[model samples]
Target: MKFKNRRAMLWHFLKGNKRFFVLSILFSGLVSLLDLINPKIIGFTVDSVIGTEETALSPYLESLILQIGGLPYLKQHIFSIALVVLFVAFLAALCRFLFRLFNSMAAEKLIKRMRDLLYEHIIYLPFSWHNQNQTGDIIQRCTSDVEVIKNFFAEHLTNLLRVVLLIVLAVYFMSGIHVGLTVLSAAFIPVIVGYSFLFHHRIGESFRKVDIMEGQLSAVAQENLTGVRVVRAFGREAYEKDRFEEMNQKYMNTWIHLMKLLSAFWASGDLIGGLQVMLVVAVGAVLTIRGAITTGEYIAFVSYNAMLTWPVRMLGRVISEMSKAGISIDRIAYILNSPVEEDPEEPVNAPLDQDICFDHVSFSYGGESPEVLKDISFTIKAGSTVGILGGTGSGKSTLMYLLDRLYNIEPDEGKITIGGVDIAQMDRRYLREHIGMVLQEPYLFSGTVADNIAITQESTEMAEVRAAAKIAALDEAIGKFGKGYETYVGERGVTLSGGQKQRVAIAQMLIRKPEIMIFDDSLSAVDAETDAKIRKALGERTDQATVILIAHRITTLMKADNIIVLDHGRIAESGTHEELLSRNGFYRRIYDLQSPEEA
Candidate 1:
């Protein structure tokens, strides 16, 4: 789950696509080598053809010149020399093109792999981890941070390699012309490199601050967009706008500070580079006048030194940009390093169609927090209906989450079981597949009504979808829409009323045909008539499945075979409706509150 460092993590991600980057580096080396040849040819032409200096080309090149009819033939046909220069230029351009192409291919593949892995890892992460992290912040890590890493490899890292190689080779070529001039030129490199390292160290913390501010800005925007409806309903649009603007301004200020630092670094580099150029030019002129180096050799040496100009400047830029990559990599690693939900070591697909037991189960959301559910014990017999009544914060939903294994209870706290088999030992995927829960605030994906209902199935079957909708008492509502079952539900089912969304969710679960179904206050949004109708339909269809209903409504739980009332974190009463009413306990108190007119 955790990587030792950035390099180890990068190597892990580079698994399938390293070959493409290898090819890119190879082509880039070819391009750098090819680029060195043109200056040599230009120098050779100037010295031999025009000035009558001895041909100083290497033996292999001299042999090629002989094949092309010797120095006298070249002097008469000087254009042939131009043709050779142009040929080298064309090959350099071709290699440059291939280098970029392969580099681009590698970058795209690397980003795709990163995205796929992040998405997969996120989905499998525990619910507790999700609760502890913010949605917008996580999104920023996945998107913006991932992009920074892509640029790191494709642009900065590769550029670093290419520039370093070019500088070394250029210096070597310059040394061949005049070792003294080469020494002077190479001396400036250490200064530039040392300055770049200093700048890199200083700017890294600045980039980190900027990146953190950007994530905060992204979170603010995401929060506003998601809760736009709440802002509109409360007439707080102006307040929300001000809030976003404040965050945006902070983000902008941080970025401006970073840019200012970068500008200073670049401007200083240019000044140093210019001074180096002046020294090289002044010294080379003296050497040429003294006849220590010929005019052609002086020009070629200058050309090679000129090549170092961009690469030297770029070396600083690349190193500074590389600092941003470290920040991004750590951000991504935070997500990847978080442990994912793992199955039990020896998991079993236990039969869930049996008595569901919560045995001495106690839970706290955090270690130091008060227990949400304390010493809780209950049972739902196989193929029977049960109801739970609780007030807000009575840990009603928490109980269902525990049964679903969304939050595992510590071994010392307690255990839950179905068919006398501990739920902890069951395969998570298999357990969840057999237990269908419809939550209070139903979330429907952006899809047709039929699609939402049939989401559990691989392929949508209209017949099954319609049947599920009928049981949830949603068929008539679907018929009212022009598109009926095909009607598009907007984001989070915003297009549907609260009751309608609940019905859709109920229908979605019904289509799955799970052995155990829990309705976690799901019917509270619907009217009593619709609620009664849904209960009747469920009674007729779900004869063989275990049902556990949690609700605040007395009428909702009145018809259950057994009802348990949770007060605070413990059970206050447990009995049938008639028996509980006769006892005048917690269930009786709730019934009286709801049916006051009857009372």
Candidate 2:
């Protein structure tokens, strides 16, 4: 089934480049037919010029011309026939060359098409799927592994097609001259193909491991590069080097296995082909001597045998490459075939009026483990702020994710509703459209300040985007930039300070103007002043929106209408700022520790 999935993925990807894909194969097949012609032309020329007949080409020309009663320069015409044969051979080769060139270009176009399709799909995958998978693993799949597959397409795909055509045409030509020799030539096909397939399976396993190793190596390198500062701060350069070398060595071993399979594939093909040649020659020479076939005919047979060498041998090489590339194909298909997180039921687009409710909501991923969120009940009135404070592993963000229905598999236990309509019953897209999120470490795209701010909801007008920026308090900062809103940010907005990234993220969310805004400790990077200003602006900007702010800073939630302090996945205390402080529970202690002035 996975194999079928892989084929389906390839078809889907190639559907965009169907014309180029089809044309490339046809052209490669045509070129391979020409490949058969050169040897025949050479053999025919040899027989005509040096055969046991007198007057190389004149006799036939003279006979033909004499029959027409207009013989013109018979000797010169004979010489011209030889020139014509040479020219025909040259022209055939020229056509083959051009066909191969076009074929390669077409394959490249197909690679681009596949790459774009895969990359586009990746960006759209749900965060739940991406959260479980590593960034380096995904990156390796898109780059090195995909390149191996692309190279296989641009080179070996046609070569495989060419081999099939070459053998078919070669066999047809040889059989026309001598049926027995052609049969003898093809007798090796089964043995060679069988042996090559054995190596194919072996190499496929090797390459799959190679793919895994590549991901590991990429993970190490990517982590080290991204966290070089962390590495140096801890002062463990030698340990990191040893770690990298170990992964590199694992990759080297996988490479060795792949190389061995390639070598064995070629050797077995060549050996079987050589043995087949011996049998053909021994029988053909005896036939020649007995006047059953001419010396020239035997020469042509040798030419056919010579032509079989590359195709049969190349058959093995192509098989090996396909095995490796096939592993890559499956690796990529694993991603493509994975079921993305989908909404549980038909979505309701009703506007919110009352409190959000969690009726015994419980969830777990994959198997029977302790529930991540069990009997998680909640309520927050419309146009109010709700704060969730919990220990590190207490499902704080998980609760927020549930509101967006980011998981395909819904909670096994209960119902969560907004405006009396169950969230599970609401369309995923519509729910997300009405919700905005800013994570603890806000991610920014590689673009201008305006682009990152307006990413989720695109409006072409710069003035409109700046309006959101001004609300998030990023307007003054952008104006000071050399290019203003047009100023380009480095990758991941690495050039921007942490607080700046958070503000831009908030600006992005603000532009969306969702009915429910979720902040998963998003303001941790900002100074107290900026945090207070943005919170104030946010409260005003969304006077009718429900705001859920998750934070460790007690000051961040002191003014909230409701605060739910989570202790071991249950609410320890839930009330307004004054009520929770009076309770002297988790919220009270945290607040005291954070804001001694207020405490």
Q: Model 1 clash pairs?
A: none
**TM-score for each candidate, following the candidate numbering:** 0.94, 0.81
Candidate 1 structure quality by residue, lDDT tens digits, 1-599 = 67999999999889899999999998998999999988888888888888888856679988988998988998999998889899999999999999999999999999999999999999999999999999877988888888888889888888888888898899888998999989999999979877987788787788778878776787788888888889899999999889889988888888888899888988988899888888889999999999888888888888888888878866776887787688889999999999998889998777888999999999999956788999999889999999999999998999999999999989999899999999999988899999999987888889888988898899867998999999999999999998899888977443999999999999999989899999999999999889989999999983589999999988887789999889888998898989999998877777877874532
Scored by lDDT, the top model is 1
lDDT of 1 at 454: 91
Q: How far is candidate 2 from the true structure (C-alpha RMSD, Å)?
A: 4.6
Q: Candidates' lDDT values, in order?
A: 0.89, 0.76
lDDT of 1 at 529: 89
| Local accuracy of candidate 2 as per-residue lDDT tens digits, 1-599 | 13366667677656656666567677667667766665664554455444542223347755775674432443335565566667766766776776666666666776787778777777768876887898867877887767877777667887788788888888898887689888988888767776776677666666668878787798799899999999999998999999999989878987987887688767866677788888889999998888776677788788888778766765765777776677788778877766655555545677764579887777675455566776778788888889888777788878888787776435457888888888777777878888888877887778887788889765557777988888788888888888888888867443888888888888888788888888888888888878888887876763588889998787887788888888767667799888988888887787777755732
In candidate 2, stretches whose alpha carbon ends up further than 4 angstroms from where it belongs are: 1-22, 38-75, 94-98, 101-125, 139-158, 175-218, 238-292, 320-333, 341-346, 365-369, 408-412, 460-467, 475-487, 492-494, 539-542
Off by over 4 Å in 1: 1-5, 204-264, 492-494, 596-599
Could you give me the TM-score of model 2 versus the true structure?
0.81
TM-score of 1: 0.94
